[model samples]
Target: MSTSPRSTTWRTRAAVAVATLMAALLTPAAAHAAPEESTPVYSYADAIREAVWVDTGLDDDGDGRPDRVAVDIVRPSEPAQQGQRIPVIMDASPYYSCCGRGNESQLKTYDAAGDVVQMPLFYDNYFVPRGYAFVGVDLAGTNRSDGCVDVGGRSDIQSAKAVIDWLNGRARAYTTRTGTSTVQADWTNGATGMIGKSWDGTIANGVAATGVEGLKTIVPISAISSWYDYYFAQGAPLYDSGPDRLSDAVESSGARAKCAAVQRKLVDGAPRTGDRTPLWTERDYVKDAAKVQASVFLTHGMQDLNVRTKNFGQWWDALAENGVARKIWLSQTGHVDPFDFRRGTWVDTLHRWFDHELLGYDNGIDTEPMADIERHPDQWETSSTWPPSDTRTTTLHPARGDRPGVGTLGLTPGTGTESFTDDPRLSETDWAARIDTSTPAKAGFVTAPLTRDLRLSGSSQVTVTATPTTRTAHLSTVLVDLGPDTVRNYADSAEGISTLTNRTCWGESTAGDSACYLATRAKTTGVTATVFSRGWADLGTYASPDKGVPLTPGTAYTLTVDLAATDHVVPAGHRLALIIAGTDKNLIDPPADTPTLTLDLARTSADLPLVGGAPALTRATTGSAATAPSFTPLDSVSAPGPAPRIPRG
Candidate 1:
């Protein structure tokens, strides 16, 4: 075994080369690493192909730098029978491909955060292993992507198309290895669907508009369709004041970042609109509703205070107008909370929908009944169409003065005026923000309490002429049912049935489109309320006050308070109390310097569409009873943490 020094050196170099070659072969490749490849890396019941980022040279908007696109393919681990490829469910999300913050954090519902958190891709993250490939793609301008953010505009549209094309190719590559045929060249050939919530939900609508070659079906859960209602309700900014923040608050990269990127694009080759024009039409979903062709399964929450419940209504209306076959599921609960992901039923429902449409499977999604939760009944109702055709109106009147213990019935006809001075110095706490305002109520008009259990459920409305001292003032009116004993002292009222206390449940606010008429001749707030059936009852005939002593013709009943609505059942044995005022500092958040309101009751009266036969007023037998609902601080109803996964990417 003896050897020369030169021979020994040669042997050492040969050994070193062998070692380096082995190390290179052992290092994991950057391409999506299979779950079982390294140290038994996390295997989410579903097969997952780790995301990989790629560069696209198109500046998209001449932003100098090339935009980067990234995608992750998740497939079922089990082999398919014969030659069937797994169907593809392509979902686009905004996440950092490198940092993994967007992918690993929350899947985007309303959470207490300072930026937008998208959770759609991760929602049911393991669902892909159930024989479908889930593709999560990043748009051109977001994390690792190199194009200017065009919001829901052209850039986003182009990226969506490109992603779809890429997924088609990826699925072909995937099928070759997995022995599946679920994904075909044509999305509609076998099965391919889109799923998302909120902004991600909106993407389905946008892509459908482009007539994308193969977007079979869409499950748009809790998505926003009307920018007007989502941003400004009837020209008024929505009061998104609750602690459960919105997507924009958390997702926006601060206002400064947005301004910088947008400005840079405008200066560089992008078209510049000096003033308001139709240039932003692409970002407006409502205008493009007619172009959406895919069948959609829409879900929304009536009690969704953040995005305004009207968005769902608007979408439903637009889809119908466009002759699109769409189904909706409205709930009284908050956004995405109803899915109950623990049970895995929600995923099944979505899967069934895609299977029926994309795979041409007889999953019977189309034949399945539509479902919704009626607020008051505290039950789910299934129907073939939305907003059940059986919906009817029951109006409760505001009878005052004639009734004794029912308070100096100021809502009586011929009453002169009821005035209240608002002091912003004291300030009002609306939802959570403390802001200065001249008055506490500003969204809707109100009436005196009805001397009975007034059910104010299912699309309630009120009209009043408001003479604001300033240009505008928010008006909120609450119609309360002052039950038996007209006036009784009670307390401890919680949501749900039979959860009672000393105080009786008496009032409900006009939730969605309540209105107010300004004396200044300006278009007042639109008044239309879609009260969830869970809490308040529909308004019906009420007992008029006894016709005892007559009041002076011109005397005024000055009743004052704010009005709002909720999704909780009010118990029986409760008097109907309607307190109308200029501001609802508790439920609604408005800007400071709120205007002062002056309403003359002499000029206000109800255009009630009465339900039951007009009932007669009975004289109080012996003793008189009346318990007015006094002002009590409101209890907050918002939850915080990671957003539940309902297509919020």
Candidate 2:
């Protein structure tokens, strides 16, 4: 064929294009290409909000059929069409339809067809567009799920586990509550990550402890690993009726009679004596920490008197013992969320964490420091590991003859005896008063003014050899930081973030959920002394949490009280005070009769988890005592009260 010059040029161009196309297709990069990262893959407006009832194989409400847990999910509409099998970020909570989630008390808003229009909190609004599914389950009985609210018992844990099973095609799920039409999660990659705070987070811990197949990671903030620790402290009841109150608060089905039998079981199982039973053992995730396959990212407030630092401390220790992959964030705010405390950093870090865990993005989050701790209000520092990795346990013995009502804390134990009567009427505030002034109800021991700053990173143990006048007596101990300072008061709100007039956006917004949330600032309060840690114990239950060992009258016995864990820095010139008293009126129910506690001071000592080299303690100058700083009343300075009934957002 005779070709013109133009025809030859066109033919050459086409041939070159074909060669380039074939070469590109044959390259390894073409086969293993990364997903486009310029913009999010899915549309938030087009997200699906549907319910699936997963069979739990138990008739928890006494019905003949198996109880199916109601799982309300919001995810990208075209995950399968996008050629991406998305993973799930599930938050199975009891608060979806009850007290709500977050600081605004946001509930699940629904559309006309009874579909969930708004999934509470920013999880759905933020992660759904990133090509991930967000599932919010109505744990067994709390919302639209079948069965009773068994608290942290088998039903609660299993109900959430069923949803995980359904995601991995290991359990049965239906499109409707009673519909026979089967629903499969074919679009899901079967890797799930759970995250939540408080009770919602507790569910995550419980589920992960079951060693579920597809659970990839969990971010449990301010969660309880042991329900026994939540309600009782070494046989001392934190509240008079802890389990009963908690069960009543989460039972949202309105048909109380339906779960009356289950409710009674919880109450009966949780005895007032604060002894560990099989019921508590079932709820104790610590016991089953060996089964956890998921990497954990835990966050908790050192000042959280509600859930308390012990919950996280004990859990953290257990996870470490099991050699589980974990990261932690310890804050000064009480029961507060990291999003509120560190806001921008928290959001960015969380996004990276989710991307790494759920989307399989190599974000290098695992290579980063494993622990982030708040040294002061709004001040944070990262460490290679929790408790600073170099923390040392230093023992400080109580010495007498320093001052009445104020004993010296030093390395050498002094000979003498200090007697204090257990007064049922004394509160923590009353014990604070006895620190300087002589009082028969409490014995106070203070370290001399520290020459250098000393930081404590973990729990402190106070062991006292004492003789009680009665067999049963309550021992309340507090670790106090005596220095004039201002700190974030977390005890005021559930999340420790007070709602403000300002609003800030975290991610994209949709018709159902907003990208913006009300701005929050840490509530700050000034104080000369703050209770760094506190622990209560019923002496009768001292020997074992499962057994009561009454003390013989006038017989000296060694009792150890583990104070709440803390991350606090006692500045130079400040003293660390240990207050040993009777019952803390604000926390525990007092014993019937008052008993005198005679402490053998030489045998009494406290072991502190010091973060650095032990600082030298200077003896008090005898010439003239330094005037004490004007102190803000402990009540005036916000301290966490009883546990809030609401879940974290």
Candidate 3:
């Protein structure tokens, strides 16, 4: 109390210095106590293989007993026998007994003794010899698990969570589904990491959002965070019976009657109305992102039309807002795994990541860049953050001349109007077919050739003030690159990979599980115009997705549609085009009646997140119309059809 302020400050600094010195001295000792990496610490031939059933305490099948998730584990025999506690790398999946995993459709192979002889992919073969336990759990109601498939619901998530609990000595497990023998994970250190792709990866995301203990990190590749967004977008139903069809596809039980009730619940819950309700909220991981305690490594394809880029875009933003540590790989391929895209680099990076997170290795991975974006095929660029963290949103208004259906994009407000009639039979390609001509089905607008290259890094927002001739109408907005170019045609391959006769190997291979896979190549397509991004919305749901307010005929209303996010570079001499049309027949249901839409040219504009370009308008009055080039219709090269079906694996 008698000490002066200056003297107190000096004392505090001295105390901090002493504590810092002590920590520095102790850190070296702690680092020395950590395990060292050596070649073949465990023998692959001597790895232990066994199975256990973890109790989730949920009777989703109504058998009066808790659901038991079947887990097949392979670990280092010598270390486990010597009482060494090792970390776990777990992959909980529903495809073990169904369509299988990877391009080869590799399923889990078992010996006559019911012990797992093979695990799909190289996770078990590559990691077990390096001193880690690899466990593959059959998700509830799939494979050997005892329950009904809930399709990312509570039962599905709990089944995986229970295994983590058992590893941490917080839950019960048995040698069999009804066996009296207790099975314990006494050899595990209780630090777990989950990884997978598609539905398998979706389970990892769901469990991580629960904030469960003992989970160190998760790698969700091409995963879904919200089922609602996956099937519907702003009241525009992408597909009918989406959930029901998915549940039916994954359930291995031939007896459909066994889970008829659950199937009915899924159908009733979805409703195909594009509205958020309690059912969707329960399945949305973004709503509970703040509860996540584990770090995340996300991977997705920007050209993935099946799951779409919005899934990763929205989830990544939510994780950032919650202050969660995250890393991402945004690729150009469609729904393809990184292993096939960048084999050598992917394996090396993944190995270091697992070591740092699960084994507590002091690697500098966390200090590296947070995002890797494939600017072009096989050309990747790493950045400190996604969207470049310096992207600017620039709005371009529609400027019209004497043309009735054609317009130009510029900074100045326009005076004329453009109109289009909703056509139910019109596909995305159909709209592009009329880009050079005046058509009633679509209104086309283009910008002058860019003087310099422009890079678009995120989603684009299209705001239109229009009046519908009918009470309700469907609107589709597309951002197109108007120039001749060659790009990957993801629409051809279901998984975005074409299997080649040539085979290449990655990682180590075993007799039971081969690390070699059929080589893959993207299907290349040449076209005069390529759609960079697209969006759809139901006009009636402009105000609220839950309820629709029918618009009065001739009453102007403003609607904003968020286009899918993408990472693309528009080279010089290329023009940007905005095509406004009716329903996209390839993706969604069309309106009941065709409606004519009158667009107010002055109020309609598009906000694009662009980088490395000056904000200048290309007005029709400034002699910029000469810079716009005419192109052959896109349909001349390829016609649009139904959206590509998602690959089973």
lDDT of 2 by residue, 1-649 (tens): 1133422432343344334433432356553543212136578888888878999988878877888888888888886675556789999888878788877778887787667887888887788887789998888877778888888889999988998999999999998887899899887878899999899899999999999988878999889999988888888777667566777787765536688888888878988877888889989999899888787889988877668778988888887777777788888787777767788888778777776655555445766888888877787888777777678887888877556666876677777989899876666756774577778898988765665677778788998888899878888888888767777765465434566898898657876688798887777776667777888887776567586666788888777988887777888767788888887875777765578998898888889888753542322212213444444445456333544543345
Q: Which stretches of candidate 1 lie over 4 Å from their true place?
A: 1-61, 64-68, 77-82, 95-126, 165-191, 209-211, 239-281, 340-344, 374-384, 393-462, 476-592, 600-649
Q: In order, how many clashes per candidate?
A: 78, 1, 0
Please report, in order, the local distance difference test score of every candidate based on alpha carbons: 0.39, 0.77, 0.77
Better of 1 and 2 by lDDT: 2
Better of 1 and 3 by TM-score: 3
Cα RMSD (angstroms) for every candidate in the order listed = 19.9, 9.9, 6.2
Residue 440 lDDT (model 3): 91
lDDT of 2: 0.77
lDDT of 3 by residue, 406-425 (tens): 78866666766789998777
Error of 2 at 81 (Å): 1.1
lDDT of 2 at 400: 79
